[model samples]
Target: MVSLDLRRLRFLREFEERGTLGAVATALGYSPSTVSQQLALLEKDVGARLFEKAGRGLRLNDAGHLLAQHARVLLSAAEAAEADLAALGGDIRGTVRAGGLQSAARRLLVPAVARMMAEHPRVRVEVFELELEQALPGLRLGAVDLVIGDEYDGHPRPRPAGLRFTAALEEPIKVVLPAAHPLAGAGRPVPIARLRSDIWTASAEGTGHHAMVVGTCRALGGYEPDLRHRSNDADVQLELVRVGAAVALMPPLALPADDPAIAVRDLAEAALRRRLVTVTRETPPAPALTAFLRAVTDQARNS
Candidate 1:
């Protein structure tokens, strides 16, 4: 009788989700040739052809699909079993693979990780900086165990099945300007229309923040912004504002404490805010993950 290898099944499932052996290898920290060799060995062990050539690439055959479906269940069960064992041991110890946007990584995740390291010395965490769009699919594909993301008031992300979301923080989005700018010392909330003529800096197109900036300007000012600079880096945006090159809309969480060269003001609309959320699979979380999540929430509250 032939036995199935869980590691190979994991590779197969990753291949199914990623649509390429190279992607699977990258996610799993293996070489492409190793991934191909392992899959070929799996096919031999199962006595079936698992993949077939399609144009310039390879795709899973019917047998591969069926096995991959079972692999999902088996892999989930394996995780469940590990969780059970960890619970029995009564010690929060394990490695957690997590990912998040750059702002969250700096503001919330980094501090939380520090606290976790001080408290649970045995728990390990690996973090990746990923865009919100990429992070969600990474969760589904098992490339990341947890993810942190943002949701604006008007733009809601699509929540895929078999996942959980926990709200960590909610803060208003503010307009940022150089300290020497005319509007910096304005005693009242800054109206969107007031900055219509000023050059702007924002995240690149296709990002949620860019859409928010454009949509808000169109709704309030009746004109599109002259976006002169584009970057996803919060510090870079703030720097642009500090140098009087451009103004931008930014969240409070992304700001540094008491910067002398920059000023932040509330939007006149008062309804533009974003929620920071932590996402994980629906399965019972390990103790380390539970602890890490708690730490992240605490950090957000304190920040």
Candidate 2:
């Protein structure tokens, strides 16, 4: 009878999902050499070649793919067993790792952590600020027990198998401008066509927010924006707007608490909004994670 190591099986599953040794290492918090060695050992144990060179990168061969399909079931069963044990323990006393985008972390996750600390003192919550690209992969690899993710209008993200998502909030995206700007006090939804001549600041290209801004502008104004600055930091974008350097499209949660120099207005032509969600694996979540999710949901609803 052959015995397979669950840890190495997990590594293979992560590699199959992530498609690279470096990504697997980052997701599992292991060195690249270690991931490679473990997978090699797994191949030795199974008496088959699992990986093959694909140009400069490595990809799983047919045998590896077949093994990985089985590995998913085994890993999920292992997780289910662990969850059962946690349920039997009857205490939310374990660590729950979570990740989210910047604005969500500040507005949603921080409050959730406070609630978790106060209500479930024994549970430890570890938080990481990660964009959707990194967060989703981390969630699939079991590095993150929960992820706060966003989906913009007209930019739906594909949901991978073995994960569950629950909607937290849906808030409009507003056009942020300098307080002294001419249209700052419009007191109504500002049309994007009116801002065509204005210099724009947006998230870096290829990001979901950036795509939404570009798409909304092109649809409403009939021309591409004069994008002068690009950044992922909402605070930096708001600062640029405050200094009269550029105008930006931003979600409400990204706004500073009391920035008198920034004015936010909804877009009349295209009302852009993003849906925030909490993501977890399909298996029964740990008690601490479930508690954290409840806290986050409550905070999001009240906010």
Candidate 3:
């Protein structure tokens, strides 16, 4: 009989998701040596060679990939069973691990958590500020129960397999200029092409924000933006604009309702927007999970 340990199976799945033993260890709060030892034990139990040396690191072989597929199913089943048992108790009391982008985490998630805690005193929510790239993986790997992500115009998020996505809010992506800039008080929609010579600040490369800024500029502005700064934080980007250092493009959720230091303007292009979404696994939700999700959705609606 093949006696498989669920913990070892989890380590295997984590390694598959993370693609590095060090990444698995860091994410799970274990040491690399411990992950290696458990995976070795799993291979021994299954009586198969699951890994092969690829340069200086280990890579999963065919058998390993097959086993990892099974591992995901088994882990999901176990989680469903846990949820079922928790439901039998008829109490909305459990920890809901949530992840979100920085702006949504502050604007929506914080108030949602407060409301959930007040209504369901036994429910505890832990929040992690994560970008869409990090949030999706964490949701698939069972690290987070819910994710609040933003999709920019023309940079649609990939459809998450085995997950449910719900649209929360859609807001315009506005341009920010220094108050002293010539177009700062321009009452009409500012043409992007008009700012070709201005230095700009955008989120870091590879993020949707960066991609959208570069793509929009090229397609609409007819010139590449002179990007002088890169940051994922909205406050930092706004500060750069406030100091007359650079102009920025950002969603309204990321902008303060009242900031006199910077001028916010609509882009000449129509329907340039960002859509905020809620993502979760397709598994049956527990009472706590349902309640927490409702709280978040309510906050989004109110915002």
Candidate 4:
């Protein structure tokens, strides 16, 4: 008779997602030794070696992989049952963990949180500020209940299994320059080639924004930009442009609708735009998470 402890199974699932005892410990707020001990106990109960050494860390073996799959189903069932039981008591509330990019958090997620708090006081929501690389994995692994991610025009991201994506908003990716720049008041779509000599600021390397900026310049403008500053924060990029240090490529949500210090212009290429999407698990969402999703989409659409 196998009576697997749900808590131990949770540690296994976290290990599968995070890839190490130390990481699982950090995420679950437990010590590394404690995680190791619990996992060892799980092996004893299952009567099989679930983990094998991979360099300095541990990885799931065939047996471990099989059980981890079962663990996922069991955990999801447990969570659904818990939510249903809570609902029967006239309380439809559960903590929803959400992750998003910096701009999405500022523009959509924070407003949605406020709406959720005011309307459904009992449903708690936690926000994690993460980029697409970090947020999507967390959502697929059940660490986050919802994610707000961005997509560029040419570089589409692969959707992981058991996740659903819904487009929420689309905004043009505009060229931002100092108000004093010669092309600031050009009164037309700014010719990207004209700005080839100007220094540029954009999101850090390996991000979609970096690729978009570099690719757009090379493909359309016919010259590589003198990229001087790198930052993921929209405000930092805009500040550099506002102070005449560097120009930037930014979407409308990244800055104030109208700022006198900076001039926003459409690129000569009309197809340059950013798409924001909400990503979630394919499973049926609990009542609170459903409401939170509604709040996020409504805020995104109305904003």
RMSD of each: 2.8, 2.2, 2.4, 3.0
Worst window of 10 by summed lDDT in candidate 1: 134-143
- Better candidate by TM-score, 2 or 4: 2
lDDT of 2 by residue, 1-303 (tens): 557999888889889888999988886678999999999999999988998999988999999999999998998888888888888999778899988888999889999999998999999999888877777766776778999888898999888899998899999989888999889895677889999999999888877888888898898889999998998788889889989999998888898766789888888887788999898999998788889999999999998
What clash count does candidate 1 reach? 0
> Of the candidates shown, which would achieve the greatest TM-score relative to the real structure?
2
lDDT of every model, 2 decimals = 0.86, 0.88, 0.88, 0.86
Per-residue lDDT of 1-303 in model 3, one digit per residue for the tens?
888888789889888877999988777767999989999999999999999999899999999999999998997898899789889999879989998888999999999989987899999899988887766756776778999988887899888578898999999989889889999885667889999999999988988899999998998988999998999888999999999999999998999999888899999866598999999999887788899889989888988
Candidate 4 minimal-lDDT segment of 10 residues: 133-142
Query: How close is every model to the real structure, measured as TM-score?
Result: 0.87, 0.91, 0.91, 0.86
Clash count (model 4, backbone only): 0
What tens digits encode model 4's per-residue C-alpha lDDT throughout 52-155? Answer: 99998889999999999999999778767866776677766889998888999998999999999899999989997877766664565567899888888887
| lDDT, model 1, position 55 | 88
Clashes of 3: 0
Best by lDDT: 3
**Model 3 poorest ten-residue lDDT run:** 132-141
- In candidate 1, the residue pairs with backbone N, CA or C atoms under 3 Å apart (3 or more residues apart, or in different chains) clash, namely none
